[model samples]
Target chain A: MHPTSDKFIPFITPETRHFWEGTKLGELRIQKCDSCGHKYFPPRPFCPKCSSKDISLVLCSGEAKLYSYVISHLPAPGFKPPFSIAVVELLEGPRLMSNVIGCPQTPSSLLLDMPLAVVYEKLSDEIILPLFKPTEKIV
Target chain B: MKNQKLVVIGAAETTSLGDIPHLSQVQLHADGALNALADAGLKISDVDGIATAGENPITIAQYLGIHPEWIDGTSVGGCSFMMHIRHSLSAITSGLCKTILITHGESGKSRIPPPEWPWPPRPGSYEGQFEAPFGTMGPPDLLTIPFLRYMEDYNITVEDLAMVPVIQREWAALNPKAWFKEPITVQDVLDSKMIAYPFTLFMCCPRTDGGGALVITTEERAKDLPGKEVYVLGAGESGETMLISQMQDFTTSRAFKTSANRAFLEAGIEREDVDHLMLYDAFAHLPIYGLEDLGFCERGEAPNFIRDRNTAPGGRLPVNTNGGGLSYMHSGMYGMYAMQESIRQVRKVAAAQVPDVKISVAHGIGGMFSASGTVIFSNQPN
Candidate 1:
């Protein structure tokens, strides 16, 4: 894996350490409430839906649908131009922001509601970002 | 709060707008405060309350030589000033303060030294952890990502989206104070340089330097003031998410709906009652979302409403009559400017003043739909 510290990195906090650890292990982890069976993203301590502390980390199917996106013409630090910044709706019913890889970054190529699967890119030893790509597999 | 009447007795932008490399961020706040105070025919000593965002209230109070009994530092985002207005209304009605001065100033383009923080938020913060890691550059990137989904779901074409700025530019051409006064067409918008997909350079607000302020007092005191009183008929504010990606729905703004609905309920007015409007336009899509979420049009119909010239110069509802943040002058926090235009319309002194505008609604978005605030103003006391 190539070490890329130039990119933005998440400061691992106690609450978010589990999700990051899961990402490093190739598992997409989100919080699910045991009390209300609610699922949420970005790794909060409690369930957003039920405000329940009775929550646990659940593995995502790593399958998703392209909910929305924008292609950047401006340059950023780690990414090249014309890359798509997307929010993918996971099969588990929560949406998260990621880049869509393995496809051309254009309106014609990145179809809305198209099936996508997750692919993790190792940013650094501690950080692995979840990106997505178009898939032919029926969802 | 409803029993008593609170009115904006004084309002003014900085003495000069557009570019002021000389005025530091805090200095812009002081200038706006002083000008608004002058407009109200009062001295700094007359102000008993102070509220500001983008700069600390404590700092601004000391800088303006005001010993405020009440202070607010509600720094939500650009719309923080709108929240300040809402809070000031409550504070004045509660007798927490007698006179409130809300100030907003930003050296967004100038980037003056000190009190300014570093960009690309540090790690350990929520945004740094989740949002920043994705290589999002700024509001133009993050705030605009959701539009594609909205377009797909609503079956809106790119041509429909271009009309928002086109109509707003028409309003801009009439206002001499506006930054971009040149008229532009939908094809012009499409022909401009693309900054982000589906968003061209012309569609985004210019990074300009400016500031604005407002002075609020009860109607009883306003009678002795120097300017026409624009009464705060009703006001409401709400927050949706800290991150744009977390917004509940891409097609509409829950925060805009919740805030404006509360304002309408409090004002006791319907959509038809409002003759003028100022929907913040940091990006072209905001007015589109604002129209739908604020209940001016049905969901997914705002594009056509705008394209049909319903919001244009001769349109039924004159929106963004000040050219808005898009062309007017967005100096970082645009909520102040939005409210200023509403007050100007209600005062009948606007550059493109709509005839018989008894009521005007100013709606603003804080940070990438993170928070929202709506204020309904009326020339009539009732």
Candidate 2:
């Protein structure tokens, strides 16, 4: 059996290195298209909306709303059972998949459209992951 | 081209379904192809075009001692075989090939695991960089994202979603070959172990080992064949964004609407004209989304429509009569099973046949609402 841990280390690329490093410094980095002013997640070189190559990295406020979420009871590699996997819509208008770390992984606790804030977890010296927690603790 | 009607001369699933540990994936393909050939009374030499998913068409051809003039390997997840039927129709109509064989086989349950690829996604790849890192592994994980939102947006309760499987199990009870023949109640579904939140064990399709094949040809050739001729009245396919998060709307599938609308328009019929439907039910939410997206019911009304038992056996619209993927055999891709059920219903040989079923529409979704294909079949010539 593979070792199961709660941390998942992502591969760093030239396009995503800045975003991962931003997490290390406790900043949520996203890309904004200079031409279309469209902000997006999972850092890319060009704008997915307008197909413009003129893009710049902008530090996000790290505030998001829980668009939707799932409490995964199945065992996944490097993750414990019953963890909440969420798709959070950032205030800037892009949605990204992450784990909700602070709240209980239950439907009653993880309400839809609940406000969340980004929190960084340093998995290793080279990787720092950005996960979400409720703005205030929810019972 | 509207007058150029294609027909399915033969369709057959593997000799046995669910937990066939002896056959390899390619062998399952051969099993389905040979069964379909026998069903059509045709030989390997009669097949001029071949299409398959999960396995390479060239390898299937080479293994089955077949050489084809036309081949399609459009692997867009579970709906690939549906797309194959649409593509095969065009190929046969254009004189690209005479006899087309579409095969589907998957060793989803019993196959030996292939060696893992050493390299992960390229740093810049969208899935590698964005989705996979967050432990977004497979359909169960990815599809739940949209489904959760859909439930919240529409005020759909978990009980409403459970009704989909409950009603499907009723149809499965009548199907002798259905993997889960015993009936289940809505409470049974809600109590089933949770795989993902809002998706219990019963709400998800079970992994099985099986294969299916379809033999298609021009209407003229179908007339010469002895089997009940199920005409391909219309066919349409479309795709949207690949990732679940990138979808334009979480409440509905744009691909399902586009593909099904095109199919209905091409068939020159409205939703009321159809007597039967086979919306792929890999997950319970698919049919809910499909019913609404395909215009069977209004948006946010699918849960009610299903809850009212409109899709159950003996209902106004009989859906998944051969027990859907929820209760039937789902060998990875489920489009072929849905296609087989539609053909059976049209031929009037289904285990739970609907009365006076003239037009049956089969719709398929692939890659978590990423791609869609809709094929409408009828017993009457259009």
Candidate 3:
């Protein structure tokens, strides 16, 4: 049987290139609808809320609250077992899926609504993945 | 479209329930369709409409030598078959086509190396570009994120979640075809190897090789059919955001509420009217969400309801009597199995039949709570 790979490499699309590129500069970029003032994630040209084409990329606070998370024991292409995958509610009011680093991947450690900050890791020259790390230092 | 005259005259699952290595995906579809046809005492030529998921409608048609006047390939996810049931009701009622055949088949466990057909997601697609990049593998990984939030918001303990699989396994014990017939306890579920946080191995549905099909036609045609008539009382389908993170609420499912509410309103029945229930149990959390979202129980009350044995066999509400996807068979998309069990209960021929089951409701979820479909069936024509 072929073993599942642990490495995760995302394809950069034209619509989402800006968000990925922003990670390289240690910034979290999101789309804001100029007409309706709706901020969203997974970059798109048009606003999903009001269907407004007038949208622009803006850097977010890079700070979030842990909305939910899971510690996956299954092996992936480039990931080790017991890695925590999380959905963090951004300070700018959007939610994104990412891994929680800089902390133990445990139910007791990964508390819900805990404060988190974005941290960038250079996967390759063209790719910079943004992950979350707990802001509160573990004793 | 309330109180439509459409009826389901035939329903049958594949000959084998689990682990058939010989049957290819296309062959499984044919096997299900043929079994459903035989159940209806009809021929392939009698089927004028065909609907399927996980494969192209044309491929199924051409392979089975069927020339359908209407075809629908609505591939949402596991709940695609439920959506097909809703769509077929409209098609048959609108005089678009008659004798609709909806089939589902997946070699989830036995098939090594995913099939190359159906093509991978486009690199530019939102899932491909965003969700897939963060090591989101499959349903187990994607759904746990929301479920974790649900557990926290509702103050549900891991032991409460374990009750889902434990109760379902109790029902599976009475089922001869259930994959795991042995009774499992809450401790067993908690002790099972953890796949994702809050989700142990038993909480996740077992992968199996199976398929099922349902045949629906007009009331007039159904009157002459050999099988018992299971009339479609009401049907509703709705979709939420595609991504789990984009969902407006993590604790409850909006799609499930919308679809089930619409179905109940169309059927002109109250929650008390349903005698049997089948909620797609692709994971243990699904039924908990289904119970609340479908209005059978209040939000944050489902875990308690299960612990009280309200959904187990002999309970007030008998759910997943076929053992569900957890203990029965989960061939990737598990909606079809749920539908089949609902039909069997309505016909009073299920292996673990609910006493006096006149009204049955089958609810399905696709993707990671991305889509929902609810269908209400009755033995008595309303």
Candidate 4:
């Protein structure tokens, strides 16, 4: 059943099924290159660093810092009025682009170098989108 | 005796830039290709290599009625065709093809009426189900983050950034082929529509439909060609990532920095040696970032340089002589035109060509400053 606020779907792609299954267990999963030891987003079968097929999925620290972000005021079809999309350079050093929730979507609100923590948005039954919110919710 | 040369023997464009309601994208591209070939006194059979950006690669091939030995269809961004010219030179140098036809065209204006892409909403994709839902359709609005960063990093005022579209509008006024030829002052740019914060409507390159092409050949073949021969000196390319959000630096284009340095070094030239610069100005703030990245100004000093009129027609450097993508026309593809402008200046054929253009740098950034291709050209054979 869908939530009154929004729905969470747990649909998974072939390459990321394991990752999603892990997220379903309340863990943030990331893949690190076994050969080069580099981490990456948009998880792939092979490591982008050294193109090594050998990689491992590991739980990640959801805490992160704001790398960059943009807020949109103009309205589009599906999304709510406005939101700030960002690249969260995870404290683990792997960068992931996700929405920063619980904050006003404005330049003044989405400060670069700001401290934030992940907030998982259960989009559908199978899909768990990780979002970020400022720790202090600083005004 | 095996050493051959690849020179730009011909170039041409549509008569004007605007909503080309009459022609399809492929037709527009073909018209430009035929015109460029005619300028070189050549025919379709003369072109063995076809490099293009955007859709309709085979349509152009069939329309021209030739099976090309090479089809360089890398849609890196607006500046890709300029990169293609460099790649074409490499192809010729490596004995891939002698006569090459490079082109850009699109009914970008008319294409808007088509339905949205049939592809499903991709959550991982920053576009579609992500940014598009929150508004951010394309170009000007999407460029807002970098626009803000430019101001934050440089202490530039909105008026200083407005100088781009304003000055470009003046140049467009002179080019009969320009889309919006109306003259605009800095006040007009600031006063125009505001799409995003700090960026007004006039400060952005408009969406339009048009086509342009260039035919390059080797120096050995340059002996018999009647058209003015422009030489390809050096080229470089770099990109951090296809996705905009993942780039390590937001205020700067990593591709632009790496590629510009590589371009100059390969050309065996220094920044001071370049006489004319053709930078892709799809967004008003782009040229400012590019200039700083290319070392035309000290870090954070591009606005001051613009204030000094360094890039204006009568300034120390003349950029975008043919109105640039801002005023001329942006058919969602500007790389070929970037190459075309450099060739025109080198050959002294542009309507606004400066008299002393020796080395010209054509810069292009694609996909949210992800892809970069830099080319340095000269009249002298290198």
Candidate No. with top DockQ = 1
Which candidate wins on lDDT?
A: 1
Ranked by DockQ, top first: 1, 3, 2, 4
lDDT tens per residue, model 1, B42-102: 8899999999988789999999899999999999888898899899988999999999999
In candidate 4, stretches whose alpha carbon ends up further than 4 angstroms from where it belongs are A1-12, A22-26, A34-37, A52-54, B1-3, B112-136, B140-144, B147-150, B153-160, B183-191
> Fraction of native contacts in model 2?
0.63
- When sorted by TM-score, best at the front, the candidate numbers are 1, 3, 2, 4
For all the predictions, what are the DockQ values? 0.82, 0.57, 0.66, 0.26
Q: What TM-score does model 2 achieve against the real structure?
A: 0.95
lDDT of each candidate versus the true structure: 0.89, 0.86, 0.87, 0.75
Off by over 4 Å in 2: A1-8, B112-124
> Which stretches of model 1 miss by more than 4 angstroms?
A1-5, A137-139, B114-118
**What docking grade applies to model 4?**
acceptable
lDDT of prediction 2: 0.86
Clashes per candidate (backbone, < 3 Å)? 0, 1, 9, 19
Could you tell me which 10 consecutive residues in candidate 2 chain B have the lowest summed lDDT? B112-121
Which 10-residue span in candidate 1 chain A carries the lowest summed lDDT?
Answer: A1-10
Evaluate residue B85 in candidate 2 and report its C-alpha lDDT on the 0 to 100 scale: 82
lDDT of 4 by residue, B241-266 (tens): 75566666666778889999988877
Give the top-scoring candidate (TM-score). 1
On the 0 to 100 scale, the lDDT of residue B41 in model 2 is: 76
